[model samples]
Target: MDQNSAVWLLLVTALVLANLPFIMVNRLFLMIKVESKSFIVNMIEFLTYFGITGIFAYLLEKKVMGHVAPQGWEFYTIVFFMFMIFAFPGFIYRYNLRNYLHKA
Candidate 1:
């Protein structure tokens, strides 16, 4: 794939995966079902998705460019924040909006 397509793929993947922990089934990793999930559990799952997204991005970048670029702490910091922002809608819906739903 080309660099531009790879970049868009990574962004889209990050956006969807970032929300999975908050918005999907209580099951972890879409397996290992739980009766309920706590904040900490959700966070752990969220971080797992983040790691998955990172690996996916790495592979795509490597494939597109034939090498992986070195990244500094600042790059990671910004990317982390971008992931968090991508998750904002799901976070709000799960924590803030869900309670308001299912009410008469």
Candidate 2:
């Protein structure tokens, strides 16, 4: 795939993955149904998604460049914040919009 395509793919993947935890609270990894998800559970799921996105990005980078590039703490910190930003929509929906969703 081209660099542009790969970049977009990574971005979309990260966005979707980041939101999955908030969107699907009934089950973990589509299994192990729980009555309710606590904040700690959501955080664990969020971090899990982050790790998965990181792996996907690493593979994409390796495929595009034929090697993995070394990154510093700054790079990781920025990426984590970006993932947090992408999760905003889901967070809002889960916390704010979900109540209205059922009432309407």
Which candidate number maximizes lDDT?
2
Report, for every candidate in turn, its global Cα lDDT versus the true structure: 0.87, 0.92
Cα error, candidate 2, residue 70 (Å): 1.6
Q: Ten residues in a row with the worst lDDT in model 2?
A: 23-32
**Tens digit per residue, CA lDDT, model 1, 46-78:** 888989998998888888999998999999899
Candidate 1, which segments miss by more than 4 Å at Cα?
none
Report the lDDT tens digits of candidate 2 across residue range 1-104: 99999999999999999899898979886678999898789889999999999999998999998999799999999999999999999999988899898999
* Candidate 2 runs further than 4 Å off: none
Candidate 2 to native Cα RMSD, angstroms: 1.2
Residue 37 CA displacement from its true place in model 1, Å? 0.5
Clashes of each: 0, 0
